[model samples]
Target: MFSKSSNETKIAVLEERLTSYEIMIKKIDEAIQIMGKTSQTISKMLAVHEEKLDNTHKNDELIIDRIKTMESKNTEEHHRVIERFEFIDSKINDRIEILDKKVDEVTKFRWLILGGVMIISFIFSQSSMVVDILTPDTDNVRIEKPR
Candidate 1:
């Protein structure tokens, strides 16, 4: 009877330990399920961030393209303006050359007229001296009364 009672006590302790192990396993399963849900939520948030980053990158590319296009247009306009300025400068230079030639002609004509006037004045003075010598001196003649 003593042996039978010891065996019954051992069996009861083992059954209690099995029930505790089962309870621990159930809690672990619940924790695993919560962790899986949290992991799924984090993955969704990361996907949304990636999409936003891609959109931003695309917008930056578009802005760069627009800037490049504007730069190209500005370069073409600059070249055109330079060409126009060169043409204007050439025209101005040609006009200045023409004006210089006209001034030279006018100066030459003035010198010629001055030389002609000097010669004419000298000839007129010489002719007046000759006429005075040829004319008889009237101051030297004395008046004679009739005898």
Candidate 2:
């Protein structure tokens, strides 16, 4: 009788342990399902981030190309402006040279006219003195005695 009761108690204890083990396995399965869902969510987020990064890279390349094009245009425009300034400077130099020549001609003409006037005045004065010395003046004659 004691041995039968002991075997029965051992069977009951094994059954309780089996039930607890089954509950633990169910909890572990639930945790694994939740982890699977979390991993899927993380994977989706990573995929979205990768697409955004690709788009940003493309936009950066376009921006760099636009900047390079603008710089090329600016360089060409700068060269054109410099060429225009040089042309204008050459024209100004040409005009200045012509004006200098005209000024020099005018100065020479003025000097020539002044010299001609001085020569005429000197000749007239000398001729008048010679005429006065040659002409006789009888209205105011006077005699002087020498001692």
Q: Which is the leading candidate under TM-score? A: 2
Each model's lDDT comes to 0.90, 0.93
Model 2 ranges with Cα > 4 A deviation: 118-147
What's the lDDT of the predicted structure labeled candidate 1? Answer: 0.90
Q: Assess every candidate by TM-score.
A: 0.62, 0.72
Report the lDDT tens digits of candidate 1 across residue range 1-147: 569878888888888888998898899899888998998999998999999999999999999999999999999999999999999999999999999999999999999999999987777667967668766777776889999
Q: What are the RMSD figures for all models against the true structure?
A: 6.4, 5.2
Name the top lDDT candidate: 2
Give lDDT tens digits, candidate 2, residues 123-144.
7667977668667765976778
Candidate 1, superposed: residue stretches over 4 Å from native: 1-16, 111-147
What is residue 147's positional error in candidate 1, in angstroms? 30
